[model samples]
Target: MINKKLIAPFYERLSLVLIGILALGFIIVQGKEILDPLMFGFLFAILLLPVSGFFEQKLRMPRSASSFLAIILLVAFVGGVLYR
Candidate 1:
């Protein structure tokens, strides 16, 4: 009772399900080892370093103050996006 006309649609649906299952399995298996925490730390440190130095060299504010300012700016930007 299998209709020949239905074969292409059936294969297309099967291919999509297979690809999704593979992607889900990969994420479940490698979510931690493949992703980065130290990479984030390094990037954040590099970004703030210049801003902190700008304060110390030009404005004469302490590193801690510059870091706080950067964090506040980041929070404001993120909050604006979320609110909108």
Candidate 2:
């Protein structure tokens, strides 16, 4: 026979997990404006890593120059999309 007592702890743990998830979702929603640009910059930097490495390694560009080029390209790309 199944015991109610045995399942009680599992239900308590599940409810706590659900509540934590809801709280995290609420915080993310409230902070979207601040989080959005930060997330975009993170993703954009990740996308540019390989290109920056190429410029630095293959083209013999300096670290600062390669990074600057990557940022310039990112801005240009966004501008192009907005312009179109």
Candidate 3:
């Protein structure tokens, strides 16, 4: 049979990992309202970075103008989906 002493430490480590994961999940749930929009905006900006670069480099738009255009495009796309 396997040594019980060796198995005990393995179970202890596994339980610690499980507890840490549960704690993180609880914190995320509690902060969801504030975190959700911040995360969404972060991801949205990442998604738009390339398009904004294209407008600035290829289309010769200014930095602010390119960023504004990217935002306008996103709004229009979302509006279209909602309208449809």
Output the number of the TM-score-best candidate: 2
What is candidate 3's CA lDDT for residue 9?
85
**Model 3 RMSD to the real structure?**
5.7
lDDT of each: 0.79, 0.94, 0.96
Kindly report which residue stretches of model 3 are placed more than 4 angstroms away from their true locations once superposed. Answer: 1-8
Better of 2 and 3 by TM-score: 2
Instruction: Report how far off residue 81 is in candidate 1 (Å).
Output: 3.3
Decide which is better by lDDT, 1 or 2: 2
Q: Output the better candidate (1/2) by TM-score.
A: 2
Worst 10 residues of 2 by lDDT: 2-11
Q: Best candidate per lDDT, number?
A: 3
TM-score of each: 0.48, 0.78, 0.73
lDDT of 3 by residue, 12-80 (tens): 999999999999999999999999999999999999999999999999999999999999999999999
- Going through the candidates in order, what is the number of backbone clashes in each? 0, 0, 0
Could you give candidate 1's per-residue lDDT for residues 1-84 as a string of tens digits? 875663568789999999999999888678765557767767877877777778778998887888888777767887999995
RMSD of each: 11.7, 5.1, 5.7
